[model samples]
Target: MGYIDLEYAHTCHVKSVSDVYSLGVLKLEVLIEKRAFSQAEEEMNRDLASFALPIIEAGNIEETLDRRPVPEPTPWQLHALKHVAQIARCSVKFAGKDRPTISEIIANPETACE
Candidate 1:
């Protein structure tokens, strides 16, 4: 999938969050080594974008974390990941008016709390 496909789908309305969703899904796919979507109906109902919200909100970002051994990401990196998760949550809000503009998100200071 690419930007063109998304643009054609009118998905650009929440493009940034959708991009974040895609990244999160890809990361989960890599971690699980299987498409979590196929096994559970609930998972299928909620796309990757929606699926990540609860996990992130629960502050269990590491629960289904990638299994492959890799160097630990710094706290800054984890904070950045959480920030993206927050932005994605805001972006995917049902009402477009509720979504934060890119500028607003950029202006906010990063916080360590989930």
Candidate 2:
């Protein structure tokens, strides 16, 4: 659930849109290759979502992704990663209504599987 859900979350108030937040968190986990909030690291910015948001906002999402064994990402991979990051960034909107509905997400060019 998102901030809105957290604010008024109960069995009755839960809605399908709440899953949008879970999807966002899943996206970030895939991109970061780490737990959403782990004690494995000692740092002020331990939340992957928070850590990745600014870079995504500034169009530097590539910098936030896990380093690869390959020398560099291929053009297709990089493009795909960018799209995935954008979806992840969009998924985590503070308000549930602000997040994309499942249909919108599935149909979105950036998020839809190519």
Best by TM-score: 2
* lDDT, each prediction: 0.49, 0.68
Across 18-48, the per-residue lDDT of candidate 2 in tens digits comes to: 7776777788887767677655547543666
Q: List CA RMSD, all candidates.
A: 6.1, 4.2
Model 2 lDDT vs. the true structure?
A: 0.68
Residue ranges of candidate 1 with Cα displaced over 4 Å: 1-42, 65-71, 106-114
Candidate 1 per-residue C-alpha lDDT over 42-64 given as tens digits, one digit per residue, 9 for 90 to 100: 55443454565577678776565
TM-score of each: 0.50, 0.75
Clashing pairs in 2: none
Q: Report the lDDT of model 1 for residue 73.
A: 55
Model 2: how far is 47 from its true place, Å?
2.8
Worst 10 contiguous positions by lDDT, candidate 2: 1-10
- Poorest stretch of ten by lDDT in candidate 1: 1-10
